[model samples]
Target: MKSIFFILIFTFSLNIFSQDQVLDITLKTLDGETTNLKEVTEKNSLVVVSLWATWCVPCKNELDAINDVYDDWKEETNVELIAVSVDDSRTVNRVKPLVNGKAWDYTILLDTNNDLKRALNTAIVPYTLILKDGEIVFRHTGYTPGSEDAIYEELKKHL
Candidate 1:
C-alpha cells in the first residue's frame, strides 16, 4: 500500500510540474529599449513569436511572406507577430537597416545573447511559436515556401 501511495504522489507531482510556461526574459528593441517577453505577450490575446537571424535567407523569406499577408491576418484574427532577431553581437547592428529596408510591420526585438532562445530550448533559426497568454501553444521549426499559410491556419483556430 505504501508503494502505491508513493507512485500516486510522484504522478501528481509530475502533473503539477508539467505546466511549464515562458519566463520573463529581457530583450532589446530596435530603438535600444529593454523589454520583457512576458510584457509583450500580455498586450495581445495571441502572439506569433518568430525567431530569426539576419544571415538566414529562409528566415527572411518566411518573414517577408508573412509581411505580405500580415495586415489581412490581423484584420481577421487580431493576432500580433513579434519578430525576434537571434543575431549575436557580430551582426546585431544590421538588424535595423534590414528591417527598415524590408519595412516589416511586426514588433522587432533583439536577442543578442540568445537568452530567450536557450530558455525556450530552440535549436535552429526560423523557429516560430504561437503564444497564448504567455504559454507556448504551438511551435514549428524551419520554413518552406507555403509555411506561412499553415501558420495563418493555426492562428485562425485560436481566433
Candidate 2:
C-alpha cells in the first residue's frame, strides 16, 4: 500500500514536470467567435484551460471548487483560468445563467462541438491543463479538496 501510494505521487509529479506539448487547436466561442489555443497560451506566464460541461456533476463541482479560491490564486499568482465548456447544443444555452448564478470569477468559453476536447485528447469533463510560456507543464482530471493546492504549486513553478 505504501509503495503504491508513493508510486502514484511520483507519477503525478512527473506529469507536472513534463514539458508542454505544443498544439495548435482553434475553437469557437459561444458567441460564435473563433479562438486559437496557441494564441491564448503564448506569451503568457500561466494559462489554464479547463474542459467542462454544464450537465456534468463533477464538472460543476470542480469549477465550484476552483471558484472558491480563484481570487486567492490570482492574488498569489496571476494564473488565468479559461474554462471551456463542452456542453453540447442541448445544454449549451444553460451555461450563461449557471455561471452568472454561481458568480465564478473565471473566464467562460464554449466548445459546443467538442473540437477542442478531441484536439486536446481529453474525453472527460473537468480536464485541466496548465501551461507556462505556452508549454503544458501540468495536467489533471477531476478534483478533490487539496488538488487545487497542488495545481497552484504547479503554476508557481513557472511564475
Candidate 3:
C-alpha cells in the first residue's frame, strides 16, 4: 500500500509539470496595441516568451545574445520571440527607447502591471519559456554567458 501511494504521488507530480500552460493575459505592445498571450502563441508553432526588465543586466545580455542569432533560429526552427518587459510605470517608458537603440528585432510587449508575470510564477527577470503548440514545453530562469546556445539547442529539438 505504501509503495502504491508513493507511485501515485510521483505520477501526479510529473503530470502537473508536463501540463503547464500559459495563462490568457492581456499585454500592451510598444506601439500601444493590446495583445493576448494565448493569441500570440496560437499564431506561432513555437514561441519563445522572455520576461525581462530594463534594469537587469543579465536580462539585457540574454536578449542581446539572442538577438545576434535570432534570425538564424527563426530560419531553422520557425520560432518567434516575444520579449515582455516587466518594467512598471517608472521604467516602462525606457523599454521602447532601449529596444529601438539596441535594434532588437523581437515582438516587444509591456507588462507594466506584471499580470502575466504573476500568472507564469516567474520570480525574476530573464525568465524564458518555450511554448510549443501554445503549451509550455520548457522553462529556464536566470542567464549565463553561453545559455543562449542551450536555448537554441532546445529549439532545435522541436524542429
Candidate 4:
C-alpha cells in the first residue's frame, strides 16, 4: 500500500510540473520587450511555436514554407504561429534583417539566451509544436519539402 501510494503521488506531481516547463520561460520580442510564453498561449486558442536559429538553413526553409500558406491556415483554423528564434548573442543580429527580407508574418520572439530551448529540451533547429489552450497537441522536428501539408492536417485534427 505504501509503495502504490508513492507511485501515484509521483505521477500526479509530474503531470502538474510538465505543463509549465515550457510555458513559464521568458521570451523577448524583436523590439526588446519581454513576455512569458504562458501569457502568449493563454490569449490564443491555438498556437504554433517553432524554435529556429538565424544561421540554420532548414529553419529558414521551414518558416518560409509555412509563411506561404500561413494566411490560409489562419483563416481556416484561427491558429497563430510564434516563431521563436534560438539565435545566440553573436549571431542574433542577423535575425531582423533576414526576417525583413523574407517578410514572414509571425509573432517573432527571441531567445538569445537559449532559456526556452533548454526548457523545451530541444536538440535541433526547426523544432515545431502545436499548442491548444496552453497544452501541446502535436510536436515535430526537422522538415521536408511537403511537411507543411502534414502540419496543416495536424492542425485540422486539433480543431
Please, what is the whole-model Cα lDDT of each candidate in the order they appear?
0.90, 0.79, 0.90, 0.87
Global Cα lDDT for candidate 1 = 0.90
Residue-level error in angstroms, candidate 1, position 98:
0.1
Better of 2 and 4 by lDDT: 4
Cα lDDT tens digits, model 3, 1-159, are: 999999889867654654378778999999899999888889998999999999999999999999999999999999999999999999999999999999999999999999988777556789998998888888888999999999999988887
lDDT of 1 by residue, 1-159 (tens): 999999889867654554347668999999999999889889998899999999999999999999999999999988999999999999999999999999999999999999988776666889898987778788888999999999999998877
Off by over 4 Å in 1: 1-20
lDDT (Cα, tens digit) per residue for candidate 4, span 125-153: 89898998888878788988998899999
Q: Deviation in angstroms for 48 in model 4?
A: 0.3
**TM-score of structure candidate 2:** 0.80
> In candidate 2, which residue pairs get closer than 3 Å at backbone N, Cα or C atoms, i.e. clash?
20-136
Best prediction by TM-score: 3
TM-score of 3: 0.87
Superposition-based RMSD of candidate 2 using all C-alpha atoms, in angstroms: 5.4
Poorest lDDT segment (10 consecutive residues) of candidate 4: 13-22
Regions of candidate 3 where Cα sits further than 4 Å from its true position: 1-19
The CA root-mean-square deviation of candidate 1, after full C-alpha superposition on the true structure, stands at 6.6
